[model samples]
Target chain A: MVSTSILPLQLDNVSFEVRGVRLIKDMSLSFPAGPRTAIIGPNGAGKSLFLRLCHGLLKPTSGVISWATTEDLNPSDAQAMVFQRPVMLRRSVAANIDYALKLRRIERSERIHRIDQVLGRAGLHRLKSQPARTLSFGEQQKLALARAWALKPQILFLDEPTASLDPAATHAVEEIIDAIHAEGAHIILTTHDLGQARRLSDEVIFLHRGRMLERTPSPEFFTQPRNDLAQAFVRGELLWWNLGKDNRKNKLKQSN
Target chain B: MNEFSKAVAVAFQLVLGLDHQLIEIVSLSLQISVLAVIIAAFIGLPLGAAIALFRFPGRMAIVVFFNAFMGLPPVVVGLITYLLLSRSGTLGTLGLLFTPTAMIIAQVILVTPIIAALTRQLIEDLWIEYEDQLRSLGAGPGRAITALLWDGRFSLTTAILAGFGRASAEVGAVMIVGGNIDHVTRVMTTAIALEVSKGDLALALGLGIVLLTLSVSVNGAAFLINETARRRQS
Candidate 1:
């Protein structure tokens, strides 16, 4: 189990720009522990980029991303990510997990123990000897999660963990993710699936055009969004055109 | 047609009977080429992996240079090796000129760039697919390169075999550096060249058959390895 110290992540006016085009606008937000947070936005909203930034895969163009943890502990060691399209090494499923543990310098005996545990949890134990690349997309995602889980990370960042999966596969992946979270890893995910965000996340961060428009509890955000854009998004209406006209219409309709 | 048929018949006889002279030449060719490939792999794999993984000033120039060098002429490599090892030249006291070692060195010079260039291409493609995950896993560049090289083992094996093929088939470099000395440094390609020139068509045709068979076998093995790896991946 992870220590309780690395609970919250603080972003102080963090911005990320690539090739002079800003993708993540200057935004200050804090993610406290104990609740799963989901960053939800439309296409090109930089949700994945924001998750990558928080995971330290990309350096912020400016400002700071700080984890509230001890100075001596390397933040990366305590965090892991499962990419939208998880990259599996061309080796056995078991070897993939072993590779992660080996990187962390985990001892061989303990690695075997952890590998067995995570494979069982992810329901991949029976396929441990199969080549990882040969696994189906859903099983590969579970293996990716299992590989990360083997490291015993305190925080796990998942980027659209079930975006490409079918409904059945998505449900299985979600169950595995929930199992990991139950095992004490903080879950931070980005998705465009409103239902998935609502079902899995405790809080929602709604973004539009590289800017954070709303941050609220998932239940409240879906029902009582604070911003016009969030409300439009919740109602499944496009928010990019003629905000003034749309806003007046929405407001009149709400009053009625 | 009759002469060619007779040559073919004689060649088969030589092979089936295990002629000592023919065996000696084939053994020498294999020895020199295999040793050259070993040396080239030792140098080329790391150099290629480094170039693929790191970004530095002049990296593009180096990559382009090595890519072009993949087609380096064997005779030119032989000429350079000759100049280096000839008496009154640099390190002339070593007396390596006209020796099998000199031929091996020439072959290494010719093959290293091919292996390195191919490895660079294979590793670069792999690194693109692997960079995000590896970086997220806290892998430094060296660790990432090591992991990629290991994962790309089958492809690297093909690259090494490519180097071996180039080394084994080349005659210009070995002939020039090795001098085709009888019972000493004579190899298949050089012997074939000598035999053809001396109008010994039967012997030349025999060696030619052996050389062709070896090339086909090497390529067949590479294809098999690639197919097996693909099946495993799928």
Candidate 2:
């Protein structure tokens, strides 16, 4: 399914506005085929909005978003998303995954095989018969991921997948994410947790006030940010204020 | 003994002996209400689902109209059906007036709006929770609606029962349309009304007991089904 035309999904001058407030401003970005990219920003910085726009859940107000794929292959069929709160159908865990596979028109035999594979992979085989809503919060999240993975999409967009989980549950979900990434799907996620961004992402896009201020390798972005806002953000300093007196003095000296 | 006490004694004898007139009246009532509910469901379920899922101009007005129609007075429906089926009236050629068919038509008119309005409320709420997930999975509007309707089957059943309750207890529409013809179109509610006016209080009280039992059973069955669904879900 590797087609040369489909690689490097592109967004050019994408902007989204609600009412009159700009949520994502004139932004052009592209995601390559295989990187796990994390979008990190403070609250209301448009991280989730940007992810939704790229995932085709929301249309951009101004520019073009495209997957340059072969004509026979629809991009949506090859892509999937998991929301932060992990929406599940009012059915059994197995039925939820089966529903997704059925939407793709996978044969019943293949669906049965894939369902078992994903359920066991997500450590949810034991709860296959249980209604999804009856599962705990963490299990619901796991089921959501399992459901998405069952589709075997080429790109997976997750909006704050682990934001609501406890630490132990968070660790479990991270491990599942790592397994998915290792299996060769491009993963893009949004999060405010800096440590999680550093741990899970190879590339980091730091957004501030609805603008992409910096995009760099995760380690370099955390260690030495080129933008002041990103630098302040990484240092755990208050974003609206100067870092400290010493840093302010250094900034003045540099300006002179 | 007072006339009321004497009537009560006759009512008990009629019930215990399973009087044929009482049984016939009860059976016809069940048949008409059940058939009316079935017909209403065929029309109302999809109508409600479409109204809930789709967005168009005048949709809210349509919704409000259905909601208002839920409380439609049975007599008004009876009058309308009566006019339509009357000789020289529209649909007069069918000669359905003073027949069970006309009675069924009136009940359908009364029950449909109730079922459709309740269905809209239930399916709309489910849609809010399931929309994003189904869309992401590439489900179109039809499939999404079907999935919700199936998952909400228990609630939809309750809506149908509510329609049945409305149809079974209604006297005005069926009375005007069916003409309450004995042994032909007479049902429990219409018979009770006729018997009471004629001062045959014994038969009226008998039919009343049967009607009460039927209503209670329908409601009890709905409650049991709802409890089963809730338990299975939990």
Candidate 3:
């Protein structure tokens, strides 16, 4: 633990456009380090895109994002993200963790020690040698978390990490996440689960239609949302449910 | 009256009795094809991975060229190689025109694109599915390719085996470049050609059996690997 508690992230007029369709618009915000920050949005709200930009996976079309940390910080070394649907190399569960540590040039004994701890944390110690692709859906997500957790990233980005898990598995994953936060790793996760956001998030960054609607504390965001969209979203009457899968219906109804 | 019986007896004799010429030809064919496939895989895997993952000028052009080359005529490749290594040509100083080395080179050139193009398609699809996850895990471009390749190893093995099957059965290329020289470049395909030309049906039939059996076994092995990989992925 480097104890760089004062490190915060700044996004200044950030924007990302693909094929002239803006994924994330000109948004400016600062994120204080530590505690879990949840990004909540309806589908297509660019919640995932925002998390990606934060992790430097997608370069901004305009503006800058900087980490205000003392001394030099390698952006590559400072963060890790887990996707909505996890993927693993066609190796054993243990090897996935080992690969991450090896890339960072961690030694064998130390790597093994950390792997044990992470696997145990994720409740995956019993399946260490199992082929990664053979694991159940929830198990794979847990393994993805274990692999990232082993890195001990300064800021962890998660894109709906528990979306597909069963209740028991989801509970187990939440415990691992809580443990990670306890160990002092800052987290920025995107989720559609309002209850999950309320339970785990210290602060909420609410996005709607690629725009940052609010950046309020979780309790305040839920109780007294500043935007109509946020309030409608919290009441579960957002356009997403009305939209459904048929674009024609969605467009016709929303237009009216 | 017993034509089928005779065929069976000949096949049996070819396998049971260690026919010296047949053994030598099979060994040489295996040696050349295995070497060629190994060399091609080493060159092709990374090339294919790069083509799938990277952005560069003319990438689509390069991809199109490789896809076109996958169906390249073995005889044409042999002809070009033969000309290049001939005594009067620029690379003729080494005088390797009718050698096994020339045959290996021909096989490598013929199959490198096959492996690369097939691997590129496989990795391209895998990248779409897993690229975000890879980037999120702190994987650099190199590590991401390594992970994709590792995940797609089963498909890659099948590609390599397909290359081996092509190399082992290719007569036109090896025949032209190796010149079917005895005790040297006389691999199975070229040996079969020579035996048939000489009306030695027994030796040619025997070599045919070996080549057929090898292809079948190689395909069977590839099937097993593919099935296992599919099951794991599911």
Candidate 4:
């Protein structure tokens, strides 16, 4: 396996526009491997779009993304992403993991072994025969993580894996994510949970309204954010003028 | 008054006696319709998937044409087939102007678009939900379409059976192109028309019952399949 670490990732002047509205502006950054980097920002901060660009799901109108690779990138097999909502196939839990394994042409016995390993790791082995959609919301998120874990990608991009899960499920998912990182997979995740960022992230990429505000180490970012937008966002202050006090109090629990 | 009573009484006898001709027509109609549906599915499903997954010039026009084709007048299609296969027409050399094959061709043309367009609509709606996830998973264009089509098999089955139901019940195109030749191209729908015209209510009504039964079966099967899909999706 070639190390995605060798060259890391470079995005130069990356921009994405939809119907004359810029979603991601002249953004340029290099994402080095081997860190649990959390991307955080306001609702429309283009954090999700930036993650999509990193996953090669979106093409920039005018920028370049280059990877440093020791050997061939294969590009196809080197990455996996779990969307905010688990994008489940209309299949059984076991079949879902098998489908991912089949993509790389793993032998059937090895595929079965891998499925058992990941499902047990995520504590979903008991529900392996059940249809994936039948699982509770939290369980589905766990299965999604298990599916991605089974892929063993060089880069795992997760867009808010715990956004909609319950507390126990969230804790369980975080543990699995930590376990995956321990096995040496670099993780790039996006979230609005400040506490989660504080707990898991090695670095933070602070974005606001389609532009990078600040990219700093996690401890430094939480203690003293340099960008006004990042600072306000960290304190649960209003980014948009219309945010009512009640809505903020209800939805904005400072994470970590 | 007497004629009406006779018709009704004979209709009962036809039901009780298992009339061979009426049964033959009903069975043949099922055979042709089933075969046509199978063939149409083989062709229409992939064609619909291709149209939805790929972009090229004239794609909109093709979709528009298929949508329009869903409501095509059976008589007009019959007339076109008649003209093409009639003596001194373009295809007169084959001498298939009034045959079961001609009837199958006409029904195939009438129903293929219905199957294709319905499949296209089902896939198009699902694509809205799955497209982003699929692209992000590095599912190239071909694999994405294949996955979507396979995922949507339940709805596709309904579309195909709908086409089959329409093909079996349709009369005008088969009547004209098949010439309703006795013991040959005669199918349930055309035979129904013939027997009704000749005051042979017994056979016509018996065949009509079989046709109704088939329609009911198709609807029941579709409901079951749909329920299964719903359970899985939920």
Candidate 5:
């Protein structure tokens, strides 16, 4: 939302490990400004781990993740993140936005204006004075997005922002994410929901077993995956350890 | 049974009539204990929060030290304070011993570690839930501690009350340092101890009743506040 942007985020052979088990293995990718990107993978695919490393919430065990930084700006100042389960401060809905803004060191009057503007846009104006934690699950997620929206972050990292929502709530959240994207902020999110990836992303990065198997435009990637594992994933066939489970179940069904 | 009933009668009359002597003891007790809890919170909450937030070479040892000191015997604290304030001792020139100031100092010393240790625990739990979001928002260590303390304020109130509980119920430290001088440093706990030693059963029972009521009232307030917070949080 500013004249200058922290775009073209580059990751060069980055790998993350914990307790001797690698979660994100030797991933090197470049994310330019414009199109929304979704990292799609099954459970334990290290999608969230990759997102966290890029967000600077965790350090890579090896290699480098860097942003195009300006001399005057801290990389953190230009980005914000919304977790799967949003954390609400024990305060009013308005104050939650205010707190994030205050941390950004925005002036008093600007904070008030931003809080007012964001809550109004997010349909949270009616709940402005209500305690944030008391909000229902769907409403809490929306509030989380609104809080991040108030920051006017140049890049928003959403870690499965809609993973735990009902249909109506998911629709609303997708709309909000699109709205944020339309406002010229770069979007990077991780989702296991294939339909969500198809609907929300311009490009898809398929991850399997801590590795990037493919990166392609959303439609072409879904239609023709280059990797054999990715093709099986696109075909809705279980692969890896899950393939063994699927085979046993099929064999038992045949016997029965 | 007859004597017990008579004691109960004396306690009720003293409480309902708001006896001047009882009021003096209750007022002085509130003054010293409340002041002690306030000062302790200022020092202890930050100390606990810092310990919870930062990592150093001997961090675990410092944490264990404070946890052990939460149960520090009041007599030991009293003796140490007495020595420090004695005429020939290092801080003796200030001449604080045997005064209400000395009693307040003793209570502060007794209460701070209780507050610090409890706050360390509360803030540590909160930090786990908040670390990712806080770091993503660009908050450094100092900001994280402040934000966490504010969020955990509801539970921390009880921790502070625990500190107040120690301060108000303690007699040994205040007794040694204050000398229990009437119209000067006599508080409810020390007065109760004195009247019991003198075999003034009626007055002792009366003061004991007042102290119990005060304790229950503070705890009740803390409960009500937490209940309200829970409702709002849900």
Candidate 6:
């Protein structure tokens, strides 16, 4: 079977607003196949909202988001997503993987084969029958990745996949991510971890205050970001959040 | 106080002996209520899930309608069913009135709103949690409903049991529809009601005890299932 890619997706003047507050300002962006891209931004910078818009979980309030696809294409078969806090079905690991495959209407034998293959690849075959929610947080994230892989999507979107993970868990998740990228899927993810951004992405999109300020190659963006906010972010000089800490300390002293 | 002790003593003896009439009443009670609940679940679960997962015109109104009807007076429902099944009424020719089938029908009406209303509230909350993930997985509204119900099975079991409790405890509906016919349509609640009026305090007390045991045992089983599922983190 020949697979046609739905890449080179274009968004023109795309803006998303929640109750009159524009979370994603007028943005024109194109996502071409091949490169592993990462969206880097600070807290409240709208990275997750941007990801949701692209993943079609939220519709843009204005402007256009279009996919350049072949005549007969199934959007579901072409893309998948893994949320930051993994959502494990109230079922076994094997069954969770099977459910995604079943939604794509994969045949039973093939679904079983894929379930076994993905579970073994994640080194979770031993706990395949165990309820997924019973697994540790890291294991659940891995199962989320494994389940998405079983779908064999051409594009995978991740929203802060390792944000809450410990170092070891984050490492495991990053490894699975690399494995997915190696299998020829387009990887688009968001993270505030600058080191992880540098390691995983070929291109970096720096966003600040709900606006895309810079798009540059990994090496150049890290060395000398063009925008002032992006530059300050790279230098770790945006530490104004310490005011809250100082205020709390002063309150404690006054109480004493 | 002495009279009360004598009543309790006679009740226990009758229970241990399993009087023929008592057995028949208890068995019929279980049969009607269990069957009614089964039918109610089959309709209520998917209906409730649909209301939770989909949005349409007047959806909130329908939700409010179900919630309000959950407290629907059993006596009113019995009177309505009595009318529909009575001769010259809508379903009159079926001759179902005064039969066990009529009682089952009335109980189904009484139990369905309870099950549906509770399932809707439970599933609506779960949908908020699973919506984004399921949508990303390409599940449409239809599939989402089934997935939510399956995942919420342990909690939904409690809702089903609540309906069963209501069905088994209420007397007005079955008494009206079943006519409390001696052996043919008599159930524990209806029999107890009849026995009390006839001054057979011992039998009424006995059936009351049996009914309480059934309610507690069923609810306890549901609680254990939920507790186990919670520990297993499902």
- Which candidate has the highest lDDT of all? 5
Q: What is the lDDT of residue B214 in candidate 4?
A: 78
Itemize residue pairs with steric clashes in candidate 4.
A7-A68, A195-A255, A195-A256
**Quality of candidate 3's docking, in CAPRI categories?**
medium
Model 4 CA deviation exceeding 4 Å by range: A1-7, A239-256, B1-6, B83-96
- TM match of model 4 to true structure: 0.91
| Cα error, candidate 4, residue A216 (Å) | 0.8
lDDT over C-alpha atoms for residue A15 of model 3: 95
Q: Cα lDDT for residue B99, model 4? A: 84
Per-residue lDDT of model 5, residues B1-234, tens digit only: 998899889889999999999999999999999999999999999999999999999999999999999999999999999999999989999999999889988888999999999999999999999999888888877889888988888889988999999999999999999999999999999999999999888899999999999999999988898888878765
DockQ, in order, for the candidates? 0.75, 0.64, 0.54, 0.51, 0.79, 0.67
What is the TM-score, restricted to chain A, for candidate 4? 0.90
Task: Give lDDT tens digits, candidate 3, residues B1-234.
Answer: 375557657866987798787788888899889999999999999999989999899999999999999888989999999889998877899888888889999999998999999999999999888877777666766778888888888778888887888888888999899999998999988888888798766777788888999999988978997897778654
Candidate 3 accuracy as lDDT: 0.85
Which pairs clash in the backbone of model 5?
none
Candidate 1 runs further than 4 Å off? A1-4, A69-71, A239-256
In candidate 2, which residue ranges exceed 4 Å CA deviation?
A: A1-5, A238-256
Between candidates 2 and 5, the one scoring higher on TM-score is 5
Task: Give fnat of each prediction, in order.
Answer: 0.77, 0.60, 0.69, 0.46, 0.83, 0.80
TM-score of chain B of each: 0.95, 0.96, 0.92, 0.90, 0.98, 0.97
Could you tell me which 10 consecutive residues in candidate 3 chain B have the lowest summed lDDT? B1-10
Q: Positional deviation of B49 in candidate 6, in angstroms? A: 0.9
lDDT-wise, the better of 1 and 3 is 1
The CAPRI class of candidate 1 is: medium
Runs in model 6 lying further than 4 Å from the true structure: A1-3, A240-256
Q: Give the TM-score of candidate 6.
A: 0.95
lDDT of 6 by residue, A215-253 (tens): 999899999888766776787856652346566456445
Candidate 4 lDDT, A1-256, residue by residue in tens: 5464433778899999998899999999887768789999878889889888878888888789777755744655777888889877788899988877776667999989999999999999999999888899899988988988888877788899899788898899999889988988788899989999998899999887788889999999999988765776887876452466565444444432
lDDT of 3 at B211: 91
